[model samples]
Target: MNFQQRKNKILAQLASRGEVDTRELAMALDTSEITIRRDLNRLSDEGQLYRTHGGAIPVDQPPLPFEFTQKATANQSAKDNICRQAAALINDGDIIFMDCGSTVFRLCQFIKNRKIKVITNSMPVIQALQNTAVSLNIIGGEYDAARQAIHGSMAIEHIARYQAHKAFIGADGLSAKGLFAHSEKEADMALALAHHSHITYLLCDAAKINKPSYLHFAPLETVQTIITDAALGQLSYCKKKGVKVITV
Candidate 1:
């Protein structure tokens, strides 16, 4: 089949199954895996889909709120560094709450070797840690295709049933007004994560510091710690308010 036909088939599979694996697509299209990869790369570059470890998922419709894959690439180095520090805080057998933020998602790779229980609402997180040593408990709720996460009142209710030693979450922005997000649903999830955990850690990059989004979910004092890049280490206001600021 031609590139156009293959692309259509790939997208059709993603729409039907919510994801498309390279090998499966190759087999279905009677093409080489290399060729399928090239097509998936082109489609990813064109924003037609978001590439995962070995597959592609549909991009968010309208694309106003960034897709999970898109956000994952933004300030990637900073996110990885911050996540490294966040991972250090985790101990063996500890139960943690992980939110569906791009930065928090990076934590999956770092903590895979550790023996810990992760309670999360992110499908991507579940996929990343499925084969790892870390135990996972997925928060059941409505799946949001755009965010590649779970949400809704049911998700919040599910989170309330468990308590964690630490909560790792993200925000669209942080300011004197507190943690904010572009979507109210995300803000609510962050709040629920913080509420059910003994200690909450806000994971964000420098760009989000002091920036405020439309919806404010939690106050600055809600989280006990904030992990970010070195550029945003001088958060005197946060320190004065008893919030530990750790920069990497």
Candidate 2:
């Protein structure tokens, strides 16, 4: 079959199965793995799909676009406490770089009409701050439907112009090994925020502590502080690394 036909077949298979492996593609197309890999790369670059380490998956799915209310309900008390403390770290009018995550969303909820400017990639954060008196700027970029955050050329271009006193990030996983995220785009964006802001704070629940997700964002030494529950069981590691650990 020709290249276009092969790509179409691969996309169809991915759409039907939600995910497909390189080996599977080779078998289905009667082609070599290298050729299939090239097709996957091309399709991914064309915004036709997303390629994982071993295989490919649907691009526009749950994580690329997230639901705020469902996520907000998962860990109510932890999220709330984290938010209140996160808000405390901020001066009344400090400009902040807040990323998408239920925890950061909780922080946005805690500040009641506070005088602050929030620059974020989450649609939920934008919605939360828009009703309140907090000044907000929503970075427009490629919207990843699964994570519900925008990251790409547009988001980076807008974020580059602003310097924030503090940046709050929510990570998918963390450990003595390093800080990691599920998406390479998100990992890159988080690193950009850490470099852009004066201080970068990572807000994670105990559930994420010491876990290594598929993608690595940055190292623990790169982060200024890590805010989590005292029960996360990795406080010792954080302390040893000179990472200020905050427990609520």
Candidate 3:
């Protein structure tokens, strides 16, 4: 097929699957991987798609899906590394407050075997640790089915009733001013968790840095540390605010 034909096929695949990878495109189009990569670069240059490590997603990508699992896949590698660093900071027998953020949800896998106790409103976290060695305190409130978590005034109040050694939370966006959330309920839960914890650790991928959302939850300086896949040149500024930034 001609390059134009291949381009049409690639665009169609992206429209259907939300992303397209060089290897898969090459296989489907019966072309070399290098050729597919070149085509993707051309499309990126034309603002037709946004280039990622090994793939391209729609340039004008719609807002992320509301489901927890879908959101988890956006920056899976970065989230995994960030969670690894966050989990490493936990010591045996420590109490941690974990939020319902997709990034925080990944922390469940790394901490399942730890002797630490977890306080959370995330349904996924409870399901993950229910049979593990970790103790769990589930905050109860209104259920958010889309996110598979609990949120509302009750959930916020429940979190305030307990104190933890550390709080692991996620934010939709982050700026020098503060952490941002898409909704007030989420912001309230994060704020409550941070308030009741001795130390707060923010878990986020590099993309979240300087990204703004609707509701501003906690200030950037409020957190003791931030764990991400890349520092993205924000290390010095975070350090100046007394927030230690850890890059994986």
Candidate 4:
């Protein structure tokens, strides 16, 4: 294919699959992986996609795609509120899985003094809890620098070896349609974490409601609870589906 044609085709593939690796794109396009990497570099420089170590993610995403610093400050108040409730639900000797996000960051804010065994893929979570009393297990693999989170086959493998009494996840968009994430790696980690947990909780804010996005890691049915502010109107549906709703 010509240069323009190839770029157009790659864009379509990304929209459909959410992400594309250089080697996989090279094989599919019948070209050298070096060429695919060049295309990815160009696309990234143009603000068309997020360039990962070996792949790229669509630039337009409902998850806001904030850097870790920006995310930590985005919804501080709501995060604090939701995390308080999450910490309350977590008993003293519980085995907990903390998913990466600003909301969960708040939960980690309080977890330091606790006596819980915590498993997480968030670099910031590990940094925050490094000197704490909570026992820690860090899921390591391909790390996404912008999000400061880890995922991939290796991280998923580590997650499979652990089980948690409850999993507290940070969600981007939530609605009756599905729970959305920005990248396939995040979606995969969320899916794997949900299956390994005894109970799953998604923490989101009012802005995330009804905002449709590309990836749905797990439907509401897969989660045990959704902790959000009161402006979220779909609590009734979420509750009817057996998701323990926590709004405080």
Cα lDDT, all candidates: 0.84, 0.78, 0.83, 0.78
User: Each prediction's TM-score against the native?
Assistant: 0.74, 0.70, 0.72, 0.71
Instruction: Give the C-alpha lDDT of model 4.
Output: 0.78
Q: What's the count of clashing pairs in each model shown?
A: 0, 10, 0, 0
- Model 3 steric clash pairs: none
Error of model 3, residue 16, in angstroms: 34
Could you tell me how far off, in angstroms, the CA of residue 13 lies in candidate 3 after the best superposition? 32
Between candidates 2 and 3, the one scoring higher on lDDT is: 3
The alpha-carbon lDDT assigned to residue 85 of candidate 2 equals 85
Looking at candidate 3, what is the lDDT of residue 81?
Answer: 82
How well is each residue in 1-248 modelled by candidate 3, as lDDT tens digits? 98889889999887655566677688888889999999999999998987765677677643333465567667877887888888889999999999989899778767767899899998767765666689999999999877778999888888878999999999999888889989888888888999999999999888888888888877788799888886558656786688888889
Model 4 lDDT tens row, 1-248: 76677799889877655556577688889999988989989988888887754567567532224466467656566776888888888888999888787778768765667889999998767766665688999898988877778888999999999889999886677778668888888888888888999999888877777775778767779788888885635567775787777777
**Model 1, position 161: C-alpha lDDT score:** 95
For model 3 the TM-score comes to 0.72
For model 2, how does the per-residue alpha-carbon lDDT over 18-41 read when each residue is reduced to its tens digit?
556687689889999999999999
Candidate 1 weakest lDDT stretch, 10 residues: 60-69
Give the winner by TM-score.
1
Task: Report the number of the highest-lDDT candidate.
Answer: 1
